[model samples]
Target: MSQFLTQLGDAATAVEAFLAECLAEQQANGTPPRLAEALRHAVLAGGKRFRPFLVFESAKLFGVTREAALPAAAALECIHCYSLVHDDLPAMDNDELRRGRPTVWKAYDEWTAILVGDALQAFAFELISEPGRHEDAEVRAGLTHTLAVASGAIGMVGGQMLDLDAGRLPEQPAATIADIMRLQSMKTGCLITAACEMGAILGRATASDKAALKTYGEHLGSAFQISDDLLDAEGTAADVGKATGKDAAAGKATLIGLLGIPEAREHLDRSIDAATAALHAFGTKAEPLIEAARHMGRRGS
Candidate 1:
């Protein structure tokens, strides 16, 4: 466990360095004054950078370099940051803090926050669709499309909408849990699953391998969402790097709210077990990625 954690930390360190570089470039390339600053703050906000780590470590399973997966990882982080920017708006979750710092909207003005979100969203695609980044144009397009679908109305946005709707209508039924899961699948699972699948695709893995990775991603993503809900109930702003208990505070319909803590933790563990099983075919080929799944299911941040 110690060696595996060290390896995971090494990959996370590599991704953090890349992300910091990306943030610096964006910081230096600002056009206006505060707008660029807002964008920078949004991008540079301290977070786990887990999505990128998954992409990098998963690619390593096939002996691929981190550079090969860097763009996708960075692109996914951009999308996630943009989502937070938008999600924290007064019109949305009305958040004040993110990553233990002022949210983009709170640090800047509403207009700036909105534009930063828009620009970051655009830049995510730009990073993925950039020519010559990938040998296969189809792969680039597909990856970019996957991001769009995940972050767009059909995905994250739709999940947010459902979240708002669920808040309005309490006492959600069992089918409501399914709806919540669907929303989360697009909102959260889509990007996470893409990270694994994209890494495999770039590594030139077999179709069977790609399918297996995608399955692992799906279960891991679900586990991540469950863990997130549990964190909202159990964590603090300092530990989570975001506001705590916002779901219950906002009357949001989370798995924790409905399933209770014991049930939620059980679901998360079960999902982790399924995710671990999904990698059985790869044997040692999937160790790092399996570690990543366990990390998400157990780690707090």
Candidate 2:
């Protein structure tokens, strides 16, 4: 467990350094000063960087070096940070804090926050599409295409739209467990799945290997969301680094609200089991991923 945490921390630190370099290069290339600052504020705020870790670990399974995997990992992190920036908008989640600091919109102005998300989203594509990311054009293209779909209307954005609609339509019937699952899958699962898929693409893994990683990502994503919901249900804002109990307060549809804490915990455990099970094809090489799945179950925030 200590080794897994160390590895996770190391990945986070590497990606943070890479992202900082990317931002610096953009600024040097004539990005406006204020915009660059806002970008830094949004992207540099510390988080677990769990998605990037998936990319790194998945690529490592195929003997890909961390250097070879860093671009994709950083690109995925940009998308994630952009999502958080946009999600914190007053028009969205109305969040005032992120990573225990003032959110982008709260720290800056709304327009700046909007531009920060826009810039980060564009930068993510640029990073993935760069020829230097992979020698083969096809690999770069695959990464770009997968990332687009994952972050597009059919995935994260579409899922956010569904969540917003659910919150607005009080007259409609409550969302079923299936509905919640689908929403969560699109909103959160797609990017995570893409992180793993992008890693496979980077490593040029076999089709069966890619499929196994995808299964692991799918189950891991589910477990991640359930853990997040559990945190909201049971944690303090200080511990979580964001508002807590907002889901219930907003009458949002979540497995926790439907199943109660104990049942939701059981579901989370099953998800962790399934996630680790999916990595069976990789043998001991997938230890980090197995630990990652278990870590989801143990998350306190």
Candidate 3:
């Protein structure tokens, strides 16, 4: 357990360093100094950075070294941070707090926050699509394509649209479990799955190995979002680093909202089990990824 924690910590530190380097490069390029500062504040505000850890661990399964995969991992982090900055906008969740601090829009202004998200998202593509990270052009293209789809309308953006509509239609017919799952899968699951699959792409894994990693990512993403729902349903704001109970307060659709807490927890356990089972193909080599899936399910426990 200590070793896993150490590895996760190391991955987080390495990702931060890559992020800093990118920021420094932009600063040197004479991007507006304030925009650069806002970008740093938005991207550097601490979070678990679990997505990049997923990338590195999944790539490790293919014997790919972390340094070789860091650019792709950093790309995913950029997308994730961009989403958060936009999610906190007045047009979105309108939260004043993020990572237990004032949100970007709160610290800066709404326009700056929007531009920060734009910059991070553009930078994400730049990180992956740039030359020299991958020897093969095909690999870089694949990573860029996957990240684009995951961040765009078919994935996170679509999910956000559904969530916004849900908030507006509080009195509308409640969504079924299938509907809720579909929404959550797009909103939160696709990007996560992208992170894991991108690792396979980075390592040039066999089809079977890639499939297994994708399956693990699917289950892990579901479990991760379910845990987030549970946290908002039961955890305090202090513990969660953001508003709690807002899902219910806004009448948004969630597994916990649709099935209730006990059943939701039961579903989360099933998802976690499926995630663990997906790693059976990797035997003992997948311990870190396995632990990561377990960690997702155990959030707020």
Candidate 4:
């Protein structure tokens, strides 16, 4: 577990450097000064960078070099940062703090936050589409397409819409566990699955290998969300680096809300088990991912 955390930290550092370089290039190319600063603030506000680690580790499974995988990892991080920016807006989750600092909206303004998200979203595709991302144009295109589908209306955004709609209609029936699962899958799971899928694409993985990673990602994503819900229910705002208890406060339909903490914890363990099981074909080569799944179940923040 310590080794896995170290590797995760290394991946985060590498991806952060790549992101900083990309932002610098954009700035040199005449991006507005304030906009560039805000972009840096949003993208460089350190987090676990778990999605990029997934990209790097998944690509490594197929012998893809870190150099070849860096662009795609950076691109995926862009989308994630963009999502954070938008989700923190007053019109959305209305979060004031993110990663233990004021959110983009709170630090700047609503208009800047909105534009930062839009720019980051567009920049993600630009990074993925770059010739340097992959030697094969098709691979780059595949990564771009997968990322788009994952972050778009049918994925994260759609999930956010469902989340906002939950309990908004007093006349409507309460959301079931399945409904909550679907919502979380689209909102959180899609991008995570895409991160792994994009790595598979970068490495030109076999269909079977890709499918395996997809299954692993799905289960891992589920465990991640449940852990998040548990954290919100039980963790402190200081420890979580953001507001806690907001999910319950907002009446959001979560697996924890449906199953209660004990059952939800059990479900989280099952999800981690399934995630690691999906990597059986990769043998010891997939130990990092297996550990990652376990870490998701036990994450403190």
Candidate 5:
């Protein structure tokens, strides 16, 4: 467990360093001081950085070096941070805080927040496509395409659209477990799945190995959303680093709301088990990934 945590810390450090360099380069190129600063603020916000850890760990399966995987890992973090920025906009979830700091929209203005998301997303593609970072044209193209699909309308954005649609209808019936699962899969699962898939691309993983990592990500993503819902239901804003109970207040359909806390917890455990099981072929080397799944299940507790 200590070793797994240490790896996560190391992953976070590598990813952050790359992201800092990217932002610094943009600043040096005169990308506008405010825009660069906003990009840095949003991307550098402290978090567990779970997605990047998946990238690094999954790539390790194919003997890929950390430096080789850093660009893709940083790209994933950019997309993740961009989504958070847009999700916190007034037109979206309208949160006032994140990571225990004022949300981009709250810290700056809504327009700046919008631009920050846009710029970060563009930078994500730039980082993944850079020749020095990715080296191989084919692999870089694959990484670019994978990230595009994950963050596009068919994935995270589509899920957010569904979430918004769900709350917009006052007379709508409560969402079923299946409905909630689908939403969670797209909104949160897609990018996380992409992170693992990106690792496979970086390492030239075989079909079977890639499939296993993808499965691990799917279960892990579901567990992550379940854990998030649990935290929002029970945790304080200070501990959660954002407003809690917003989902319930918005009448958002979550596993907890549909299945109750105990059943939701059961489902979370099952997902975690499936996640760990998906990597069984990797044997002892899969410990970090297994620990990551367990960590997802225990986020709020």
Candidate 6:
């Protein structure tokens, strides 16, 4: 367990360093200076780089070296950073802080932040398509495809639409939970799952291995969403990168509002259990992912 935590920590630091370098390169290229600046600001905003760590660690569980997954990990962080920027825009959640710092829109202008989100989204694809020294072109393409599906209209954007229309959803608890899950699957879970599976794919892991990692990802992703809901109920603006308590305040349907905080916590525990079970097939090889599941269960921590 200790060793797995050490490896996960190392993987996270390495991925963050690589992502910063890529952001710097994008800034230095500066052909479209304003767009590049916006993109760089969003990417270098000091994120946790959790999705990137999942990419690297999942690859490791697939028996691939951490070095082999660097490109995919860095690319995933770009996508996540883009999402956070857009999510905080006035037309969206209108948040002011992210990672305990000013949101792009707050620091710059709304227009610049919007463009930055767009540029980062494109840059994420560019990074995914532009393989690192150790990664292959074919693998890069696959990783890009995975990320697009997770972040596009059919994924995160589509989920946002549902969240916007949450008031129209059936008032039943089951219906609300289902709707929340649908919103979360796209808004939160899909990209995380993509990170893990993309790493496995890049590592040349067997289809079976990739599928198992995906299962682990799905459960963990679900827990991540539930944790977000719990955080909104129990956390403050300082603790969460974005705003909290808005879900209930807005009368938006969510797991916490639907099932209550205690029940939501229980649901998160179920998700963790499912995720841990999926990792059991790997024996000790799954320790890093298992710890990740536990981490999601304690998201604010």
Q: For all candidates, what are the clash counts?
A: 0, 0, 0, 0, 0, 0
Residue-by-residue lDDT tens digits, candidate 3, 214-297: 999999999998998888777754655555477766666667867888998898899999999999989999999988888866
Tens-digit lDDT track for model 6 on 1-301? 3554576667778877777787777667763776666666787666557787788778877677777778778877877887788889988788998778888898889989988877777877787786345457777777778888888887877877777666445663434567678888987888888988987887878888888889988999999888877776787555556555877667665677678778888899999999989877789877778887887676654
Task: Give per-residue CA lDDT, model 5, range 207-261, as digits (tens).
Answer: 9999999999999999889998888776744554555477777767667767877
Query: Stretches of candidate 4 above 4 Å error?
Result: 167-170, 236-244
Superposed on all Cα atoms, model 4 deviates from the true structure by an RMSD in Å of: 2.7
After best superposition, candidate 6 residue 292: deviation in angstroms?
1.0
Q: Which residue pairs does candidate 1 place in steric collision?
A: none
lDDT of 2 at 243: 51
- Per residue, candidate 2 scores C-alpha lDDT tens digits across 1-301 of 4777889899999999999998999899999999999999998888989899999999999999998899999999999999999999999999998768999999989999999999999999999888766889989999999999999999999999999989986686879999999999999999999999998998899999999999999999999999999887788545545554777678777788789889999999999999999999899999999998998888866
Clashing pairs in 4: none
Q: What TM-score does prediction 2 earn?
A: 0.95
Which residue pairs collide, candidate 6? Answer: none
Candidate lDDT (C-alpha), each: 0.79, 0.91, 0.88, 0.90, 0.88, 0.77
Q: Which residues of candidate 3, in runs, are more than 4 Å off?
A: 1-3, 169-171, 236-244
State which candidate has the highest lDDT. Answer: 2
List the RMSD of every prediction in angstroms. 3.8, 2.6, 2.7, 2.7, 2.8, 3.8
TM-scores for all candidates?
0.86, 0.95, 0.93, 0.94, 0.93, 0.87
